[model samples]
Target: MLIPKLLWPLLEYEISTSSVESIEAIINTFTRKWLGFPPCQRDVAMYCRKAKLRLPLISIVEEYKCRKARLMTMLEDSDETAVRLFQSHLTINRKWKVCKAVEQEKKALK
Candidate 1:
């Protein structure tokens, strides 16, 4: 989400410095702030509640999943065309991973 995008630069900086503690601290801080629970105490029910409260009524998460599914189906149906058009720009796998992570995070809130 926007939070992660905003923190990406800081994350990269932390990675560059090879500071595991700092990276963990940053992740823990954000996890607590955004998820309403510490990482160690996360649970699926709490996550769902937090997500329902935090996400707008429209739910960007649902939209994202729908779009991703459509794109993947398109790619599968037109593998050659997709390859030709995307070449090095295709990130379906990475996007899927991000989606999965987001889902997992949402299922891991307080």
Candidate 2:
């Protein structure tokens, strides 16, 4: 419910890590306000689904990472040469911010 409404078109383009981090800070602020928490409140209360009382807050960073990984996979497996070339980002070290993040996530999972 929340995802489609709040983040419907976020996957259309890749974003820089700084942009994602800024968005995350804004999201944390809004969630804190929405959940009636103090400015200094930790993020766990807003994001911990496993907690006894869960706040329906989503992390923008997590969401972006997920969408980024999906997009990367598609690009990697794409039949179009243009897309594969763009995904390589050769001049940019073949590693965009989200690509690095996805790689780190994969390592963490394993």
Candidate 3:
């Protein structure tokens, strides 16, 4: 309910409202505002499910892929710090990939 309202506006205003951080922030805010602190963390999956039921959006997944691509490019271009950063990023990408796969599976059932 609250998520769709806040999120749509952010997507409409930003050229690319796709980052995981951005999406997470919007979700956190929406859940907190509507449901308050108690059970906030527990409600995230339910909120995402509800969002899918209403206005479906896949920008966060796209952004994760784009970020992975960009980080790989960075890794190729540099040494030391950049390589370490890229490895850290790769771990994050693996998590996003799992989440994306789950989302796809859920969508397939619908």
Collision pairs in model 3: none
User: TM-score for every candidate vs. truth?
Assistant: 0.28, 0.70, 0.27
| Worst 10 contiguous positions by lDDT, candidate 2 | 89-98
- lDDT computed for candidate 1: 0.44
Tens-digit lDDT track of model 2 for 1-110: 76655455556644464676677788778767876899878887778899998766678767866776777767878999999877655223233465676678779999
lDDT of 1 by residue, 9-94 (tens): 53223122224334545654665678576557543333364565553322223334444444444554574974546422334343
lDDT of each: 0.44, 0.69, 0.49
Q: Enumerate residue pairs that collide in model 2.
A: none
lDDT of 2 at 23: 72
Error of 1 at 94 (Å): 12
Is 2 or 3 the stronger prediction by lDDT?
2
Against the hidden true structure, what lDDT does model 2 obtain? 0.69
The TM-score of predicted model 3 comes to 0.27
Ordering by lDDT = 2, 3, 1
